[model samples]
Target chain A: MSVFVTVGTTKFDNLINTVTKYSAIKAFQDLGYNRLVLQTGAGKIQKELDQLEELDKFTVEHYDFKPSITEDIESASLVISHAGAGSILETLGAKKPLLVVINEDLMGNHQLELAYQLYRDQHLYYCECSTFVETLKSSDFTKLKPFPDKKPKLFVDYLDNLLGFK
Target chain B: MDSELGVIAVLIAVVVCLVPIFSIYFSVNRTCKTKNPNVTSTKRTKPASVMIIAGSGGHTKEILSLVSSLGSHYSPRFYVIANTDKMSQQKIEALEAEKIKISNKMEYSIHTIPRSREVRQSWLTTVLSTAYATLYSFPLVFRLKPEVILCNGPGTCIPLCMAGLVLKIFGRDLKIVYAESICRVETLSLSGKILYYVADSLLVQWPSLHQKYPGSTYIGRLV
Candidate 1:
């Protein structure tokens, strides 16, 4: 199994640090995971990523950005991402098992609203930066419900109506 | 002679009453045609151009979803993004690439403007950057002459929307549509609040938002 961690085009050092640590890597390894791919935005977690390569417990690839992380998301067994709506929508759209980590240090509390909503809806699992490890240890991703196919046509109709399109 | 004068007065009264009715019809028709740029008689004509303010992260995603849902109704779309935002550029490039692969037409372009502020940047610096970004948008807005400008809740959208408004003030027929971000279940975001006044139409994803923002129209989630 493989895990993909993405911070979504912005720096979230805390989430990167938590996942790149030896303990987190080892925990995944013990659970039969062998590969990890991280798209680490602008954060300075490259030094730690390089050191992890030496351990040889699993293969890890890190990049500042990938034009299309969808390919990475598809190949991974699990996806760990920042609690951004785009990332969540992509993950859920793909019907992949997802674990979202919200950075509490950001300016507004908006991300919390989305994270909690999805969690309550059973669409995905969410953990704050502080409780990431504990939640990771306890959660069973198989039990999560698949995201429903949200009909996008309604939005189109609304726009057409608003625009007075025939 | 008396009967002739009475008949003439009745004709004048009828014309006066019909004048208001005709004016009302013309006004409604004019607003509908101009306010809705996509109301062309046929779809075979070139699709209307839309200028979208694609902010980083979530904002970019929501806009992408909106474009996809629009399908071929609007075309030659332009995305305005922050100058330093390589991630958004990459995401858009990826989306465009996939779209081209699916269909051979290329109808979108991306423009980068200076960011108003970086994360954790000082307020003094933010003001300077914002002014620069707003000034930079003036030429781009004139160049594109987009029929419609679409934005969600993001600080980056403010200057671009203002530029569109400036164009409107100059007697251009353009519409600015602001969709409050889906994440705002209870209240509007900072950008949403500012845009509420300038945006020609404000749409909220959650119905509850209509009570707070009386003019806001409730639409289901775009994503």
Candidate 2:
């Protein structure tokens, strides 16, 4: 199975480095995932990624970005992502097991709040760069609760009622 | 006697100007005081016009997703975006195209306004730009006179909502609905904070925000 790692449209060099570590690769292999698909965005870690790929311990595919990562997200058995709301929602919407890595270097800690809240709700697993490897090795993906389906009707009905349409 | 007449003239001029200013202020304030979301108006069988404020990136995504769920009854949609925003127009078109494939009757327009504040901009420049944007949005809001104005956590929404308030002061029924972004679990964003008092309906995705601000309604994840 393949594990997709996306950093959205921002650079997360620390996340990239942590996931490419030898121990992390071994953890993935132990979990029966032999391929790694990484969307690196603006992170400058190509040299390390290349060396990791050459080792051939696992298949490593890396790209800066794509117009849409929906296809990759759909096919992945697991997803490791930066704590961007768009990425988090898309992964949960796809019903994949998501482990969000909070980028502490970013100016605001709002992403941390989102990640922690979702984690509290048992929807996903989240950790900092320091604990990413250990969390990966120990977290059970099967325990995540499925996010509720998008209910656009709620707002529509609310608006309609407010506007006296009903 | 001439000096007294000069003073009287100045006083009259001040009163005349302040009368309209205070009138406008009190009208807008009255709209804010009436926070009842369920207050129904005249029943209308026709579709209502809507003006949507689309911010860059995540804000644009969330607002459009909310718009896509809307049925055709909310028609002639007008989208306002920052002129520097390159992605929102494309996303809006894609969404409209998908809608057209399903129903074929789509009426929408896109307008661009100046960014209220670019990243790292000085507070002084932000104030100037915000004023300029509010002036720029006034005519657009006046002409469209959309029944509903919908926005999420975008800086651009402030000016548009201000323009909507202008419309309300002119004796038009305009509703401004502000939805806090889902990412905001504990606190509201800057735009959300400002629009809380001005918007007709304030929606929060998480329960914490609703608990913190009793005025905002907890809608439970509309996006």
Candidate 3:
């Protein structure tokens, strides 16, 4: 199975570093993963990723930002991303299995709320930046619930009625 | 004496015939050259024309879902997006395709304005770009003359909302609805901060934000 790692539009240096660290890549290798795609947006971790690219065992590819990030997300067996709302919603919207890692350095502290809520709902796995490798190694993916497709009909009706449409 | 009275009767008949003609001309001219263009009633009659602001990714996704939820009441929509946002255009087209499969009657237009800011870009450039975007949006808003404008929290929506505010100042009645993104459960984003004051109605996806911003209405998670 392929693994897709993305940090979304903003910079998340710590999350990128922790995920692309030597030990974390080794953990994926131990799980017999053949392909790994890393999308590090504005994060300064290319040198570390380049060094890992030298190894011949598995393919490692990285990009800053691309319009085709959705295509990559679709092809991957699992998506490991920073807890940005855009990334989280897109992953879940596409019905992809996801594991969101929170970057504690965000100023507003909303990412933690989103991650915890999704985790509590059993929609996807959530973890902190430091515990990347540990969670990957111990988590059981087969038991996770499929992402529920939520239709916003109620909220839509509320707004429409408020606008005096009905 | 009888000849003079006949002439007098003929003159009075001519005056009576010209009176109604002159009054019709004056009334038609008044309506045709009225100063205010928005003479139509603001109340919803047929489907209200809607203008929705769509940013990249989550903002666009949420706005699209809201557009779908509008059902058949809001039609001939104008989806204003950033100039570089091809993803949003693609998503809209995909939705349009889906709509056509179900029913072939969705009428919408897409307009692209300059981006207000890029991620991690300098604030100096952001100010200039935002000014340009706001200027560009003015004509689009005036031409569309949408009865309502809808947006979630995104920097691109700021200029469009500013345009709506200006229209409101000009006595054009337009409803501006700003719904905070569901991702923002705790606090408002920068765009949310600006629109919270200006929007006709402000909605928050989380209750905590509703408590924090007392002016905002909460309707649970929208996405």
Best by lDDT: 2
TM-score attained by model 2:
0.88
* TM-score sort, best first: 2, 1, 3
Error of 3 at B123 (Å): 5.1
Off by over 4 Å in 2: B1-42
Each candidate's DockQ: 0.26, 0.49, 0.27
Residue B147 alpha-carbon offset, candidate 3, angstroms: 1.1
- Scanning candidate 3 chain A in windows of ten residues, the lowest lDDT window is A104-113
**Per-model TM-score on C-alpha atoms:** 0.70, 0.88, 0.68
What is candidate 2's lDDT per residue for B1-223, written digit by digit as tens? 3323332432343344345544766666544333433336756567889999998998999999999999888888999999999899999999999988878886899999988766555555556666667667766776788889999956678767877876676567678999899988998876777778789999999998899999999877887
Clashing pairs in 1: none
What is candidate 1's CAPRI-style docking category based on DockQ? acceptable
Candidate 2 chain B weakest lDDT stretch, 10 residues: B2-11
- Report the C-alpha lDDT of model 3 over B1-223, residue by residue, as the tens digit: 3323332332343234335533554455333232443334444456678898998877898888877666666777888889999989999988777766656786887899988667655555555666667667766776787778999856778767766765665566678999887877777877777777889888887777899999998866677
Error of 1 at A113 (Å): 2.9
How accurate locally is residue A102 in candidate 2, as Cα lDDT from 0 to 100? 86
DockQ of 3: 0.27
| Model 1, residue A77: C-alpha shift (Å) | 2.6
Considering only chain B, what TM-score does candidate 1 achieve? Answer: 0.76
Residue B88's lDDT in candidate 1: 78
Question: By DockQ thresholds, what CAPRI class is model 2?
Answer: acceptable
